[model samples]
Each structure stands twice: as C-alpha cells, then as structure tokens.
Target: MPSFHNGAVEIAYLDEGEGDPIVLVHGFASSKNVNWVYPAWVSELKKDGRRVIALDNRGHGDSVKLYDASQYDIAMMANDVLALLDHLDLERADVMGYSLGSRMTAVLALSQPRRLRSAILGGIGIGMIEGGGPGENVAAALEAPSLEAVTDPVGRTFRAFADQTRSDRRALAACLRGSRRLMTADEAAGIAVPVLIAVGTADEIAGSAQALGKIIPGSEVLDIPHRDHMRAVGDKVYKAGVLDFLSRQD
Candidate 1:
C-alpha cells in the first residue's frame, strides 16, 4: 500500500516480485487488491519471474478522492499511471487494464506509447471508441440515494457491486462523468505498440473485440466464451491468454 503523488492526488500502489515490470490497472470501483491481488494476478505473474505493479487510480481504493468531474478525466488518470512509472524509475513497462482501466490504457497508448512495452486491454472493445458504454447510468446509480432506486439493470448491478466493495460513490460518479471521452478508430489505429484486446464472447457490454483488434496494428483478441463482463474478470481462459502473451514478450 505504498503511496505516491500524482499532482494533488495520492495514488496507492503495490509493487512486488522482480524482473520486467508489468503494471496492472483495475476497473471502476475496484482497488488494486480486489482487481489484482485477490484474483491472484500478482502471484501468477510473479511466478513467471516478472515484477508486478498495481495502483488505485484517483477516486478509487485508498487513493485521494475527488468529487469534481473534471479531476477524473481518463487522460489525467492515464497520466497518474505514467507518474507512478516515473516514481518507480521505470522508462517502459507492459501495462494491463480491465473495463474503465482499459479506457485508461487506451489513453496511455495514445498519449505515451513510448512508456509502454506492450498493452493489454480487457473488458473493453469497440464500444469504448463508439461513444456508448454504461457510464451515465452507472454514475447515476452511484449517486442514487439507494440501490433500490436504481432502475436500470446495468446501473443497479454496478451500484450493488460498488457498495459491496465499499467504494467512494461520489468520487466514482465524478470518475464516470469525466470518463465519457471516447477514442476514434483513427486514434486507436495510430498507436504503435503491441496490444491485446481481451473480452468475453457473451459480454454485451464489451462490444466486438475483433473489430477493435483489427484497428490496432499487431493487436490480437482473446475471447472467453460463455463469460460476461462481470464473470470474465478472473476467468481462467483470460488469465492464461494474458500469461501466454506476457511470456511471449520475454
């Protein structure tokens, strides 16, 4: 739970193992422990002789919380990732993210390609760049007075999960507000780095992984059949694909 300063925000991070570094960014309302530790991602990668670094993005986990919508921009959050790298003195590292984290990964790839050795984007697909994902509903749900008041199924589900995780609802709502910016196909295509798009075949929220893969040069898609957005996060197939991909890079 070591912390660093990304401007005014305090980012909490975990650094473990030793070798080529791999930075793990968690999804919305999830901390480094929930997204990577309890899921055994840190141990799994460490077993392969790789260093693992995970961080709590602003407004999530033990990091500084901000209610201002403008403070939660994905680009700014991406810079938080970069600043962590700088803090650790790493010039480049392989980065992996899920859901909202994937959007931040996209921003990282687009703005700081030189800081990444490779990128893995999970729980996201073409929908991220197509201008519609569950941000508004999820935000409203988070800000709702009660979970029972959230009528949208997707929103209710996310709200329940956020409650379960004990996340900061107001900060999360701000995160959702600032995270609506989407990347165009041309923007995604402009990234020059090894990329992996991992999504579940049954995930309606993820859109088409193949479509996104086709746009990013040297990108590959790993589809976990029979898994949806919630179920796919720690799926064995997804983990194996990611491990294999990382192994190939070494």
Candidate 2:
C-alpha cells in the first residue's frame, strides 16, 4: 500500500490503471481493498480506461492511527484527499465516496470544489446531509467495553463489523466524534459541479436519494432496487450508473 504524509499523518492509497482520474473514498471502518477492490470497482473503472485512486481515510486501514478525537474532523479527512491529489500532481479529478466517505465528499464539494470535476455520493441520504446520523451512538459503541455494552442497534452492527475487520476501535470512536459535522441546505445548493447521489431502495440509513437530489441543482439519483446499504456498493446498477455518468463527462 502506497502512503503519503499530510503534515505528520500518513494516508494509505492505491493508484492503478490510466486515463482520467477518479479518487475513491471508502466508508467508515472500511479499507480501500474492502470498499473498492472487493467490490471490483477498480476493475470496472479500469475496463473503462480510468485511473482509479483510492485512499483509506486516516484512522482506517493502513493509514496512521490517531487517538485524538479532533483529528477525525470530516474537513480534516477531506483535506487528506486534496493532499493526495497534490502528491499525485492531479489538478483536479472526479471524486467518489460512500457513507462517511460521502459526507467527506460533500465537505470537499463545499469547501474545495476547485479540486473536483464531479462528485459521486453513495449510500448517503438527505437526512445525513441535513442534520441526523448515528454518530453519537456509533462513537459510544466503538468505545464500549464489549459488544454487549453497545445497546443501540445501529451501533451494535457497526461495532461487530469493526471487530470483524480487526479495526482500531479507539481510532474509529475518535473519527465518529470528530466527523459528525453536517452540511446545511445552503451548502448543498451551492455545489457547482455535476453531482450523483446514489443509494439502495432498501437502505434505511440513506433517507431518500430523490430528496437529496432535489437539494442539489441538476444533480441525478441512481436507485438500486431491493438492495440495502451493505449490498449496494457492488450492485450492477451502481457500476453502470457510475460508468455512464463518467462517460458523459468526456
């Protein structure tokens, strides 16, 4: 895993193939391999002659772990993406993210749209963008003494997944604490780049893709029928939608 320094923190990333660049950001507790490679996103994009660049956000995967809660701010993590682009000498590139990654993408779109040609926000919904999420619960769950100590269902599920992945639980708790920031309606309306908001029909965490689309002017929604949050990442509908969207950008 290739890595770079953003100040003192090291961010792990993978760059592959060639052509236009697409920087991929994975969801919380997921690494580049699990979110991008296992889903075959790299292969699919490569087939389309795209250069796939994906990074494990700080505190996840092979990136430097931070125990400080403030180190996990969404904006801080988003800047890591920008730093990677700088390291690679990319002036700008299409950016794609899922779940927590989607929120970070929105931060970039709001604070650093100059660094993006387009934005793809997956497994995210209007609710998360507006002001609601399981951040507090999830954070507490990550730090709980045991799985039995995690009472929230959402928190419990995430805790189990983190355990399964053998992730740094303390670091994840800090990430959740620092990354609960929300994007206001004004911020969403102000995004100037082409945007795609995608989610599965059965994804409870993602409030409504259609609702989110209505907020971003000219944005499009890709609905994967019958797929849930965990099942939507690698769905054929999602891959096709992304490919079609990228194709039209040329």
Candidate 3:
C-alpha cells in the first residue's frame, strides 16, 4: 500500500499490473481491498493487461480519517481522484466507481471530462440524477452505539457492513452526511466521455440503468441479471460487460 496527500488528507492506494491505466473507486464503508481486491476486480482487470489503481477515499480504509461533514462533499472526493492522477503524472485514464464512488465518477466525467478516457459506473443508475441511496438514516446507523441498536432495515445493513469492515464509524457517519449531494439532470446529460452504466436487475438502490443511459447521450447500460446491490459488484456478467465496453473504446 502506498499513499499520497490530497492537501491534508492522506489517501491510501494500490497500483498494480501494467499498460493503460484504470482507476477503481469503492463504495461507502468499503476500502479498496474489500470492494475491489476481495472481489477479484483488481486481479481481473490486471489480467486483462491494465494498470489498475484503487484508492481509499478520505475517512475510509487506510486513508486519513476526517470527522467533519463539510469535508466529504462529492466534488472534494472526486478531486482526490484527480489528485491521484496528478500524483502519478498521468494525463487521463479510465475511471470506474461503485455506489458512492459512482457519484464521484459522475462528477469527474461532467466537471473534468478531459481527464477520463471512459467512465464505468456500477451500482448506480438513475439515482445519479434522482438523488436517492444511503441517506441520513444510514448516517444515523453509523453513529448508533451498536449495530444491534439500529432498527431501520437499510440502516442496519450499512451499519453491519461498517462493522464488518472495521471502519471508523464516526468518520463514515460524517462522510455519509456530507456526500449526499446529487447531480442535476442537465449535469448528467452534459457528460461527453464514453460511459457505461451498469446496475443489477434486482438492485433497488441503483434506480434504473436504462433511464440514466437515456439521459447521458451515447452511454451504454449493462444489466447484471438477478443480482442485488451488494451481490452485483463481483458478478461475472458485470465484469464481462465492463471488459467489452472498455474493448470497444480502444
């Protein structure tokens, strides 16, 4: 694991393999290892001869923990990715993100399109515009004294995940509260880079992949059949579609 500072925040990351670069961003309460490495995403992409880079967002994983809600704005998180690219002295690369990371990737694609060769948004869909995923309830769950104290179904799910990940609950709570901003439909429509929006057919958290695809001009959608939000991350169908999408870009 290597790290660099995005201003005062230290971001921990892993860089592996070679050839064209592709950065991976993980979801809420997830570190790069748990979200990408454990799922074999790093290995799979590396096997395809890509330089795979993944980071722990501020307040998650081995990155510096920040308890301030104001510090976790989506743009601020997105800038960390930009900072990583700058640190590596690379001009542009493919960027892929899941769940919360998808939101960050969308911000980059819209605000910094020139920095992305392509964008792969997994575990996210129309929610990018419609604005619904983990909410204050999930934040409250992170703040709760214990996982058993959380009664909200969705909240409990996230709380349990945070515990399982051994993440700093307070820092994650602040991140959840601050990173709730959503992109406008106009913003989504403004993305010009090659984009692939992949969501599980059974993912209630991701909204609709087709709806988002229609909003982003020339964007493609991939449906991971019968998989739910959590189960869909490592699905074979999702990996195949992403690889196919990347191949077409080249």
Best by TM-score: 3
lDDT of 1 at 128: 80
TM-score, candidate 3, is 0.99
Question: Can you write out model 3's per-residue Cα lDDT over 4-110, one digit (the tens) per residue?
Answer: 99999999999999989999999999999999999999999999999999999999999999999999999999999999999999899999999999999999999
What lDDT tens digits, residue by residue, belong to model 1 across residues 104-184? 998998889889999999999998888566768888999999998999998998899899999999999999898778888
Error of 1 at 240 (Å): 0.9
Ranking by TM-score: 3, 1, 2
The true-structure Cα RMSD of candidate 1 reads 1.0
On a 0 to 1 TM-score scale, where does candidate 1 land against the true structure?
Answer: 0.98
Go through the candidates in order and give each one's C-alpha lDDT: 0.91, 0.91, 0.95
Q: Pick the candidate with the highest lDDT.
A: 3
- For model 1 the local lDDT of residue 138 reads 87
Number of clashing residue pairs, candidate 2:
0
User: Each model's TM-score, in the order given?
Assistant: 0.98, 0.97, 0.99
Candidate 1 off by > 4 Å: none
Cα RMSD of all models vs. native, in order, equals 1.0, 1.2, 0.7
Please report, as a residue range, the 10-residue window in candidate 2 with the lowest summed lDDT. Answer: 127-136
Is candidate 1 or 3 superior in TM-score?
Answer: 3
